[model samples]
Target: MKLYQRLHPGVNLGPTDPENHEEAEEKIFGFWIFLMSDLVLFSVLFATYAAMSIQGVALGPSPKDIFDLSPVFLETMVLLASSFTFGLAILELKYRKNQGRLALWLTLTGLLGALFVGLELNDYRILLTEHGAAPQTSGFLSAYYLLTGTHALHVSVAIIWLIVLAVQLATLGPVGPVKLRLMRLALFWHMLDIIWIGIFTFVYLYGVVL
Candidate 1:
């Protein structure tokens, strides 16, 4: 209820009893802490990636060998575009007073996101089968799987969340609680964009140059 009060405009769900905002503020603080914890997890995984990158497998394909810059770059563009679209969606929700625009943009975001996932999965399958670059084939492949696979898992979860949020908008019409939750989820989606940019630059681009 505190979240509902703090975030929603003119919809103070907080208690008139003068004890509600404190609880909401605490929940917001806790959620931020949780977000930080997740960031730490990603940082550790990135460190592991850096350590294992140089230690390639003896007979297996390395990142440069299996990674096609064109496709990965294209996937990056798609995700980036989706992030921008989601931002627009949030803006429309906040002020334009139109749930339809928000929902339309979000649906577009989901489609773009799903397309990127499809391309990645296709690339992975090709690398494993035609290129013979399975995870067990090399340390590089193992790290590749660990890093990209984790990102893919997060993308899948976000897609599911997007679908659920779409339904909420469809039913609830971006009224109160759902609007704030959607904003948070949009932020989460954009956060993934930040991580993907890091992966693209460091993991893919740097690997290609190396």
Candidate 2:
């Protein structure tokens, strides 16, 4: 908590032992490298989507036909809320050290994530069954499925990771390594939130308006 201190690659994270801090710096730097790679991957998908969205329908259902803004907007709000709850959980651990409250927040975050996935799946169901817009139906649908599905897959993985970490925190009591892991997970979760914002804007919102 020193002035001009940097803690665990997050905002307002508490300091750790020197040994752990040094190790965390290395690991978090590596994590940054991984995130950069992931950014490149998403960039490619976005480019692909942009290329296909215009002419890809080819007699299939267009974005206007398949996209329902209401559920997507709700999903966006839920995910943004989950990010806020996760931030609360981290700050709780940093300052309050209340394991129960921290776990509660984690649970809430996971539930929100699950809700997001469910909502997306429902949208998929409607697109496929009601709108007859499966991925194989057109290039636009294919690209849309690939991009959004990849993101949803990432969220599912993160939720599983969250459960694992919660168990570790309960059993391991937030030791140095565990806190470092939590820091990495926090970065990953926040990154997903950012990516979803892109999807919301570029895919869903643009699909509707443009």
Candidate 3:
């Protein structure tokens, strides 16, 4: 049991026995598996978007016509900043063990994420109202909405998760389960940032250039 525990320092042995340690490992591993499944789902969405985007504009405005780079740039900056803030919160929790600092950083991250979502929705609304770029109007618009809307949905869920995590940190401090949950959330936020980069480069930048 000691050997197993030594091999896996992340598993909290606390007052519980080896069984609890095994359970903790299982939980973390299970979460990773779930993340893998999510990756597959996102991959499918990306592929579909790519396939459909070739015919995206249809009779509506082309990507270069209605796709404004300014708001997309802002949204990208805010989300990337949120990811950095989340890293700071992780640092505070892991090293400083300061619940107050962690909570503040996390709150900032959540606010930034919320700002990104708001900007995205506003951008979509502008496309619909000012540009008449509704999803039903063209194949390109449909793919555009699906791809970006899916990402926006993930960001929304992450914001809610951040709120719940902040409450947990306040109530429980940096306990084992809380730390694990925070780690998972960090992974999620970072993944979203990476995915957004792909979107920015492939979907937006390429759309504009070609």
Choose the strongest candidate by TM-score: 2
Per-residue CA lDDT of model 3 for 119-164, tens digit only, reads: 9999989998999888898888888898899999999999999889
TM-score of 2: 0.93
Model 2, CA-based lDDT? 0.87
Estimated TM-score for each candidate: 0.85, 0.93, 0.86
Model 2, residue 135: C-alpha shift (Å): 0.5
- What digit string (tens of lDDT, one per residue) describes model 1 on residues 1-210? 445555433323343323443443455456567667877877877888887778765688767777789999999999999998998887777657677687789899999999989989998989978998888887777887888888888888999999998898888776556765775677678778988898998899988999
RMSD values for the candidates in order, in angstroms, are: 4.7, 2.0, 3.7
Could you give me the TM-score of model 1 versus the true structure? 0.85
Worst 10 residues of 2 by lDDT: 8-17
**Which sections of candidate 3 miss by over 4 Å?**
1-26
lDDT of 2 by residue, 88-194 (tens): 98788766888999999999999999999999999999888888888998899899999999999999999999999999998999788787788788889999999
Give the Å shift of residue 17 in candidate 3: 16
lDDT of 3: 0.82
TM-score preference between candidates 1 and 2, better one: 2
What TM-score would candidate 3 get against the native? 0.86
lDDT of 2 at 200: 94
- The most accurate candidate by lDDT is 2
